[model samples]
Target: TSERILGGLSEQGAPVPQGTAAVISDPVKGNVSEADVSGAAGPLPKAPEPAQIEVLTNPSAGQAAATPVQNISTGIVSAVSGATSERLSSAAAEQGAQLTLEVAAVIGDPVRADVTEAQPVGPDSGNGQSPFSLAFLVNLSGLIGGAAIFFLVGGAAERLEARSLRTSRTGLWTVRLLLGLAYALLIAGAELWVAFGLLGVEHEASTAQVYLFLALATTAAASVTMLLAVAFGPAGIGISAVLNVILGLVSSGGLAPLEALPPFYQAYADWLPLRYVIDGLRSLLFYDGSLDAARLEGGWRDSLWFLGGRSEAARLEDAVWMVGAYLVGAATLGYLISLVRDLFARRERPKTGKVAKAAG
Candidate 1:
């Protein structure tokens, strides 16, 4: 009996069996080929029987055999999917956080930047000052002083007339004019002292400029008072006091700008002399002196043609002209009223003499 070796090497890469011989079988001729091993030390061993292998086609048995492998593959796929899902969730959270931060940054930027322009000086300028200040008191004092002058002049004229002093009409006119001028000078001087020396009103203009404006304003006020006195006699002092002190101060734009006033008050401000006076004073006190050439040119043209457009400086000049015009117009009106009153007095005198004769 002889032993046969199978094809291929052992685990250590040697031939199959240490002492066995290899056999090759031919299917076509039913013959066996053997390799001799006569030089071996021992007799040959008996050959072993062929292995019996069984094949099964049953579905249950096949599935039972493959169950572990399927389970292992499924576990690997689940682990990969879980890891991918966790990574995706982490990425999504980071993106959401970044987006929230960006949105917050955009929303908070404007508050930090403080985007707003500065307002100009006016009632709505938000300067945080109350309406009643030292400046207001000083202005009110000037009005009271003007009213006192009106009363004093009226009383002096009444006293002169009561004494039967035969003064010519021309002489009386001259005296009234001189008295008005003197009162104007006194008021102007008093206002300068109170505003600058005592109250210390902060102004941008020089002392000379402020004094000039005060003089013009006081002169205008005096002229207005004299006109009323001549036209309505001593009773006109009360009218002058109301016009110059109460109505004038109310519409003067001293407490607020004209634009900020109510519609009714705004309309009244246009006709009030104190409005222009205050406007000119404010321009000289608060406004910068550097003029806009184009604006000045346009304003000059508008003034020449009696048009509406004018800047702050032009408006101040217009105020000076208005004061001058008031002086001229008031003088003419007062002279006419006085002439009419004199003519009426002459006519009444002749009638009174005839009535007395008839009665006797």
Candidate 2:
């Protein structure tokens, strides 16, 4: 049997059976001869050769080309109609090798290539200006312009008091307060017109709404300054400056959201009149008077804490009330201070007359 062979000789760089030998367990049976083993095994079969595939290369321009088949990547192919195939072949010839296309597998189908052009880059693509830039300018203008009106009104009040001989103390205070308010309204209206009308600044609120908020804020500020000047004399101007310029601007939340500030500042913002003004203006200009929607969503506490809570309606209401309160309070206090001073002067006059009678 072929399985009985133990060794073989090399032929054509591979092993070929030399002979077949048998192993018999019985002592009586003699060992099989090498010639008997050789006769038992047959010749080995011949190995097959590898198959070849043809690859086409680009031909020289001078050479007459064959009907060229487009080289397409391996994928599922779909059938194309005869008319479509003719159109695709003509397009390929016109574009030459510049256009590459994928071929569908249908027997007579033609290949179609989708052509797309690259988009060019532009200089201003991602560099548009932010609305905050305009906001910053407005804030700066408000500070400078508001301060100038305060001083101008203060000077006029001083001149009017010096020239009027018959005007009582009460009358003078009233005149100063009215002058301050008038100045506030004038500056506010002028600045708003210049910014929105002439300069073409963008804002969410209507021009009328902006004017109302600005007028309220400016009047409150101006009234307070006049009251300070009346109470403390010339030194009061510095006090007003510190309050309106330093504390007001920092706590107003104009540069950033109040919530982003430290807890102390956030708390301070609640008491500042400028905060209400700026918040109200922003609600109108940036929020498009939609802060009421916010109040409804967040409830009263949230709306109050964040200075408009949830909506523009709440913000405007709060701003108007706060500014009006400050204006009324300052005017009342100034009037009381003047009345007390007048009372003291009257009481002192009687004492001076009695002393003069004793001396005579």
Candidate 3:
């Protein structure tokens, strides 16, 4: 926008929004807020006849940015920081539905239409019969199962690795983190395999599932794994492993709905919000969550507090926030536990009594 305004001042002199900006906003066809045109003809003694704008609008950086309706600075997805972000943005822009929301919507869909783009753009994908598929239901069941196993098995290994890495150099800790991430990724891959080959679920992984799960899981798992490594001092990794699996199974709702899960599961589930992270993927895949759907569902309304109001991407934005909370919270808990332990370890020190006396 800064570039558009400044560039307008330089090239077009007093700016008419000659390109796509004027088209989508329909400033001319629609109404431009009078304020934006404050410097128009009235100020210029002989303002050149309002510069004629070309009819066809080219999609450009400037035009893609829609003016915010409220706090939301939409279209920040266009200016992604990395290549992955850029590709996701491009896919969303080109196809309103990404893998998560659009594809996931098809779980239990007998039509198999949701797996592919709808021929006529209906939920059923134009398959006259079997709009809801048994195969889809089976696959959804498999997803929940796979997700459960992914977390449990992956987490268990992570715990062992952390314990092994304790007392090692910082470099070893870094390696532990890397290996932990690998574990998370491997879980996803392994689950996909189970979904396909073992269960014969026939569900193809979507961009949304792969990316969202990997991202959220990796971020949270790394922090939690680190906490286990330092604080448990040996057993942290294994504890984290078990916790990850349980968290994945109960919280994720991959097999069962959140509301349907037993009471104890719900009790622990809230504390383990990784389920929300997982649901985010399902919501994206199955619900085909859009700006409108997001508005209706009230999903991740304010997820971009971390970024400088950049990337208001609904699914991706929500995923980041959920994972970020886990990461920060787990790390904080890790530090607190470590601090408490250090104090307790020194409790028996000869000077400890003197120090306690002095402090008291």
TM-score of each: 0.53, 0.51, 0.36
Best-to-worst TM-score order: 1, 2, 3
Rank order by lDDT, top first?
2, 1, 3
Show the lowest summed lDDT stretch of 10 residues, model 3: 58-67
Best by lDDT: 2
Error of 2 at 116 (Å): 30
Worst 10 residues of 1 by lDDT: 24-33
Tens digits of per-residue lDDT, candidate 3, 1-360, equal 334334443453222223434332332232222212212112323322211222222111011111121001111111111222334344445555424443333221212111112122222221211111222222233333333433554466568768863222333334444554555565556654654346443222364454445544554666675666566654665666566654555444444334445666655654454555443433443344321111101223344344333333444445445566766776567556656655665565668768989999
Clashes of 1: 0
Error of 1 at 168 (Å): 4.9
List runs of model 2 lying over 4 Å from the truth.
1-166, 292-313, 353-360
Global local distance difference test of model 3? 0.40
Which RMSD does model 2 reach against the true structure?
29.5
Encode model 2's per-residue lDDT on 141-239: one tens digit a residue: 444544454466556656876986333567667766676667667766887777677766556678887776676676667677667777786677677
Q: How much is 213 displaced in model 2, in angstroms?
A: 2.1
Whole-model Cα lDDT of every candidate shown, in order: 0.47, 0.49, 0.40
